[model samples]
Target chain A: MKDNKPEWYARMKRGPFEVTKFDSEMMRKVEERALIDRIKPRKKRFSPWAAAVATAIVLIGVYFLVPKSSLSYPDTQEVGAGKSEMTAEYVREHLKIGMAQEDVKNIFGNAAEGQSVKRDFAQPHQDDPNDMRTWTAVDIWRYDYGVGEGYSVHSDLEKDNGFDMPGIENGNIESQLVIVWKDNKVERAFYKYMSSKGLESTQIGPAIEDFPDTEPPISDEAKHDSEYPSLEVRAIGESTLGKFELRPRKGSAEKIQPLGAPSCLGLDTDLTITGDYELFFKATAGGESLIQNYEALEIIQKENKAIMMQKFDFPKVELYLFIPRYTDCHGLEFYAYGIDKKTGEASAFTFQEGDNAIPYWTTSPMVLPTQLDDQLVVEGGRFAGTDGATRYRFQPDLNKHQMMLEGKEQIP
Target chain B: MLTRDYLKYVSDIPTATLQELMEEHGQEVWNYAYFLTKNVDMSDDIAQDVFLRAFLHIASFRGQSTVRTWLFSITRNTAINYRKNAFFRKVTLLEWIHSASSASSAEEQYMSRTFTDTIWQLVLKLPPKYREVLVLDAKYELPLSEIASLLRVSSGTVKSRLHRARSKMKEFMKEVERREG
Candidate 1:
């Protein structure tokens, strides 16, 4: 009993319980509810039989809708030999998160110049090799589909979110289809779909449709289910209208605002337990917002920076809210909660003041991975600004708990 | 691979083939939830929620992870969230803790009775995080790295937590000895 190891751990306990019969009745109810809940006005127009019939008939019609470009290469060779041409609907439904770039181009047509990673750079990557950091080059492709017209990533946008362009100049990311490519395959894709068009205000959530991960669609599950013909989309591709500038202004350090809106990457709360109970938050606000989230014993801003870190250790373990003042959007948004490489001391990634009118900026939600170095180091993130986007890394000092960073890269 | 007839039924309700696939699976899930919560009602609720998630998100299952592993991950998340609720926290687990064993054989019943009474008593005393890692690691044999990914922490963090959890259990065992000494 007094020893460090307990006998009960080795006492050979009974394994998990075994149930002979499953509650099929309950599962049936849940399945029925899921199916019934899917009924809506947009989809209601097409009866199940009609949808299946229409889909079968529309293959030829949709193939003609493919956007063709001069720079395109013929990819019809790879179109599942003997399979019919894929419609944009088939493309959207079949495309998975980590899909091939060739498959994307295979389904959609050749990407236009402005819609791809090979856009004519002011400093063409080959022209200026000195300034560029080492990168595991990822080709980014953008697509835009419309109501009157159809899908085209290179379509001239009245207002771009500045999402795809190298620098943050002028644009809003409204209905932007982004696919990140690494080693010539899809690394991660972020497709936004407007959820509710009925309301004056719209909410964009992650598009759920994707090419089913690497597992080949061996099952005729797709073929068998005619009722669930289309991807379950409420309001698919309605582009957003209004926009906001991320440009910085003078006295920007003092006038802080929430990163985006509360719902959109502006604030996130997580529950963590180490030896203590903590509800950690990664947000872009300051002072009172810190107190509102957690009962704070101490709220300190590292080295007079606007970022505040609150520590709570009551019901055991911990919860911290790292709130930074990203008041003016354009200039600053990078923050980190990591330890210092030199002193073995931890650092808080707080916000900084910046100049306004810098158009090049990324709209990445401010988040610090729980395992900072591991996640980011493997899947590298971007440190962007109006000047141009660049590769960023969090090199942890082998000293175990600390890390190294470039200027303004480390949170305060 | 020849698609099994069960696989054929799997596409209809998303629940049909699962109902068959999970006949053996449900017991493991129910038992894991019971061990974690030490409460049958909550375990039942958590197990149901786990299966429901599996059913709804079946389309997202790319066979990246085995269905068993995925089910457990969902189970662990659901149980942790369930345990954290203020209502569940305030309620007593004492009643269910007493009702742990009902084996038929005399010697089997005696061993299980003592095992549930002593070992589980100490296990239940550990913190939620410790209880989770210990059950997953020592019980379920989940590797530390897998535990780390499941909990969304670093492998280093998971290693540290597992070490501390066992050490805490040792300390709890000592406290129990001191009480009945």
Candidate 2:
């Protein structure tokens, strides 16, 4: 209303501006979103062996990103002093690029996000120094993990059509682990951890006289917001996760592919799911014909066992509730596997996952097809060793994908 | 205040500035989205999304564009994307059918207020680029340079698009008038 708008535009001002009551919803979403952003890992929580490996390998006058011909052998670790049962020497001689994404996941865990990237590795043409030549059209999988994407303040930008502003002077900081994959193999790894500090004291960038008189805000907000806020726990696939809803579960079971079962057996082999398996045959909700994965409309339970089945006619969805049968060292991990009865394909209700700590999403909890009642859809669930149970409502079309979160706090 | 203040507020504490942002520009964004989407719910959703994204990316708010311009640009893209989504199309179709099938005379009259007039129809009929430029130019009264920045196009492109949009609108009105007479 202050800046001079067009006069005829006043006629177009379709007013009677009755604001809708979406404040609570917006607030809750904003709070959860902020919470999720905060939960991304700022510092690398590396296993001692991996950390030692990275440190040692990065030193050896290195071939960090090269598709290597050989490997480095680390010296050794004091016996009974580390969690990685594998000897540091074994790890050193073995690891290299041309490793499967799954193999990487076994070591580094599942990536937070994967993006296909094309980087032109350009060189000056040998014949013509002026001519630019691209050697390879490299297609890479850029996997980002726990990281803080620090921002730069572009002040006096009007002065520069060219981006000549001193970026380091603006005090920008970022921490990220980018694993690039080419031909389904790890091609390169880039790790950067930057922090904003006084040029006189810090060793990262240039000195104090380097910057202009116009300095950035003094608050350590960039540092603070860059890490987890509360819940002190990584989010469950709280948002986007795994080969999400893209490929249908039921296209003829081609081959038994173990999706990141973590080959605790060996580096090359995978931990396959073979022992306890359950397949169901059911009549459709309409009771017309047969369906493969649907339940026969009943709550099935067995004592002492954590897994159970509940047929909540809320959208006629069949969910197999179970906990991963891992050593009960940590808190029990629970998952609700949704069954596409038609395909008899059951998918773990996990959409995406971050480092073992961060929460992600499964699928949007849905209301029944016909009834449309006020029942909250179970977006995803989590069980922490410390915090007790709390129901997260499916906040659909709210965040990146539909996510379930526990609290509803109003953001300012 | 200016975009600098917004940048400061954002960098200070990202989540703490949503109240100020919503209070300042929520309605204009909603109205802009509403005109583009032609669906009340879709408009509301897009407006909420624009604010949500702005809140999330508050750290990246470089003060390159005015807050209003930035927000409107987001609203613009969000509206276009929502329109493009297959799920959105399906949902919109379902809503149209549901409302059409069930609406009474009074309900239809109330719904009529949603861009039912001839001029509004003509505006909506324009292609997305022209429609966007015209609305931002004539409705929001954004400067050509700002519009150029928002649309990621040159000022010349924005001008030509606006000119084309106005010419098309005039043509629609004249044709309608001739037919009516």
Candidate 3:
């Protein structure tokens, strides 16, 4: 106790429970609440939904009251200037694939220049290098909805907090509508809904509403050449588990050693395990189960439960895993999506417990693949409190390029 | 800080100033709430509410205590209120610490966990009163007078609570070591 008084107090004084990195969304929320309070009559509190409704009614009135001539796009017009119905449903219903720029503008007013991302999908002219007009280029525009609702990333706050995702700057983006214009005609169009909670169930399809009940109207392009490959993880039967070898190749498991101290390259990496819980992953692509031992600590699932686990810059692992942490009676529950970097598409693998799809949960001292095996075996299930080590394997859909845990079978 | 200049000003705090305040003391407020209510979701809500309340009612903040302590005071109150509310589900302290199992023995997990994690886990296991006082003294390193004022207790009571908390932690840790051996 005496020895602990000095050294222990020093470590405790360092504030281990203290959150080193504050969540920007929480900060924005706090500010938003305060702003609302300041604007309202003193000491009166209104529910956020009520305020939203009231504001909507007023905005709707203004939209209808505005002159028809003013509704027309004036080249420099913005989304809110005339078009208030630039919602996901509106875009899905009204917008078409091959609409001209002028026609699209007349419908949805204009993209808010400040809150949109524009890039010329082009290169230099082959013939006249100096002449900028000669080059053939497609204009791609990304108009993000709910930007003002603390949806978009403030780069300064992100940098100050040491969290950075270059291409995926919209890590916390709620909704986005992207339009690609080629030769003055809309070549491609898609509406994406990215849930900050990392719920793969929320994403139906391009032009689908958030948390839609009906199936997504999957475009012809989506059916054949999907931007993101699928990832499925399921509990394999006893027969598959018996024959499965995580590293089937000779000496392949030992070829790659576990990372020395669970290190990562991301600026705001939450790779700390709760204690000595070491979680390793069997990285499989195209049905070849490759082993990579990644010892991840409990990255305390905070306000924004869905966080970019790791920004894999490595050539082999070019996917971002967004795991939303949930703890049921079993222990810590999580479902992760392996997002493709190039296509900005995501592949998800989740485990089912009862009615819930809880991809993986660590029982007490959490670990994945408990041992090196050909199949991805997660150690924990409903009987975890007593039986312990209820192994579930990742059922790989090779054709779909997905690994999912559909059901769990007890291994004796 | 915004504590010194804006102490007497009875106006709604500017968003920038409020953000600056959050940046400075947000973690402590959050950690304090987490310590009080071992629920992450509740802590998030409590911390956000604490800052919002502070920003909205800057007029109530007198220049008596540091801004951090004031925020802590608000956080304690907010967390207490959350518990008292009918809708709030209290996650018991025991829930945070996983009971030793034959499959994944406590010894095995304890061996891998950092001493800091073990210590914190043990601290969380203590009774609410004891844990509160001990965390204030050890984690936050608040003066006895400040802690007593914040908890609305006398200095002697604070001292007694801290002593008991430390004793309990020492005993729990020793038991851990004995089991490991």
Candidate 4:
């Protein structure tokens, strides 16, 4: 205990620290003086002159930025033509069944054969049955100048022992096709070519009628399993500039497939089925029904056959529905169902009218339970003094579903 | 409620009773600031600012950490801010010692002391992470756990850093010893 080790331990021990001698008395007095310098409250201040100057500057800026150059002196002019004008590019883009008379002429230059034909409008009349108008004139164009001749012109004639001219193997001529239009609608079309049998003629009726019905050359089970079940709502096997990812909602019973090719109708095939399925399409935002743009969807069976079950052309004001295998479809309500007399493809469905679907503004705002009931009763101050106050009162017709909000003040 | 009596209550208590018992121990706090800044005036200013800020936000202080740890935390932040502001104008501890010694010829500059000069040169060369804990431990005699809290690191990490720092210092000292020999 009395060794050099004990002495060394004591020397290495942390030293006895001394206290700080800071004089904080002066600092305390300074803080008291600063607090005493503060005073009482004052009235609200106004700067009307500054506000007026800001307003004038904003108006001047707007005038320079958005000046009117149209007939309406102080108002901005509406952009683009009001009516939908069909152009050659638009024809190539949409590629609908019919093309106007002027468009065909512009595309083909001149018709090889021009003729007049009268046809009746057999579709249902809107108001007057006798109001049907008949179309009289139609034109057609064709080309048939040794089309394959250019490819074989330099080939040796002696090789095949004088086979009918170097390019003329089986009398297939190079030619341009022409379409005929009557009263702004395609009535007929045909191809022109040099025929040894003095211009062999082939008539191209209405583009839709001449769509080459080959009986599909496939079985019904093969079509249903491969093609019939597949919905070809739009252009199939056509090139789309891009692809998109589709994410199904959480806990949804339906299994979603990858987005397939877009059809001429503009709908993309998004699912294939083993069991029954119901597809729901809701607008991304709320607006008038006429403003809702059309989307196409197609379903193809395993053997590569398909059908367009739902085609959206009319104004979609409310909800749209489509049920595959309509005979198996139980609930029949509003909208019409197509019963293919040849195939018996029928389904019962309904399309509700008016603003029936849940609008994004209402459903999205009330996340908590209390917010929901408060939204339904129109009691929350959140919607006060706005268009939402009135709009919230009109509950969307969601098949009689209701939501309750908790812990919120009631709207008067 | 705070008045002259409160100030005296804090001040009149004997230095040993207040210095060892008080959480912040202002003398040691000021010394730490002084070492970082190498200026007595700035150190005093920083110490006063730390106390004022601490007093104002005292209600928010939950006493989860020791008073010394808290004060050092404030001192470190304030000193760093001051250094950043005066980045272009810097004065080394050796220069400061030289100036102080020049004013009073009786004392020699710490840089002139061979052992002190060697240690100072090696400490300055250390990375900021190791150097901070080393200076606080060696110069201010702060506990390793308290230094760890001030640096917001684990005590084991502080111990490892101190060990590495000492190893580096020993290596430097050995080189100096060789040169002198």
Q: What is the C-alpha lDDT of each candidate?
A: 0.40, 0.41, 0.48, 0.36
Q: Which residue runs of candidate 1 sit more than 4 Å off their true CA positions?
A: A1-7, A15-412, B1-16, B35-38, B80-117
Clashes of each: 33, 19, 20, 34
What TM-score does candidate 2 reach?
0.36
Off by over 4 Å in 4: A1-412, B1-24, B86-127, B137-146, B154-157, B175-181
- Give the C-alpha miss distance for residue A25 in model 1, angstroms: 9.2
Tens-digit lDDT track for model 2 on A1-412? 1234434455545542334434656656655755655565333447768866875666454556643433321111211122223321223223344566655544444432454423343532222111111213333332222222444333221231112124323424222234445577755443323233221101111111122111123223234322312111111111111111111123221111122211212111121121112232232332222112311111111111222233322232334333322222122233444544344333434323221112222221221111124233332322222232233343222223222332332211
Superposition error at B40 for model 3 (Å):
0.6
For model 2 chain A, the run of ten residues with the poorest summed lDDT: A200-209
Model 1 interface CAPRI class: incorrect
**Fnat value of model 3:** 0.27
- For the second chain, the TM-scores of the candidates in order are 0.70, 0.76, 0.82, 0.58
Residues A1-412 of candidate 1 have per-residue lDDT tens digits of 1224345655424543223223655455445544543342222345667865775565456557655431122243322222223232233444554445654665555532233323344532232111111222335555432211221233332222213321111222233344555566664443443323210111111223221232222223223334222211101111011111111122221111111112111221211111111223222232111111111112111122222333322121122223332222222222233322232223233222121121112223333323232323211233221223333443333333222333224231
C-alpha RMSD of each candidate structure in angstroms: 23.9, 26.6, 23.5, 40.1
Ranking by lDDT: 3, 2, 1, 4
> For residue A206, what is the lDDT in candidate 3?
22
Which model is ahead, 1 or 3, in terms of DockQ? 3
What tens-digit string does per-residue lDDT give for candidate 3 at A238-315?
Answer: 111111111112321111111112111111222111211212233233233322222222233222122334222322
TM-scores for chain A over all candidates: 0.24, 0.18, 0.23, 0.17
Candidate 1 steric clashes: 33
Each model's TM-score, in the order given? Answer: 0.33, 0.36, 0.36, 0.26
Best by the DockQ measure: 3
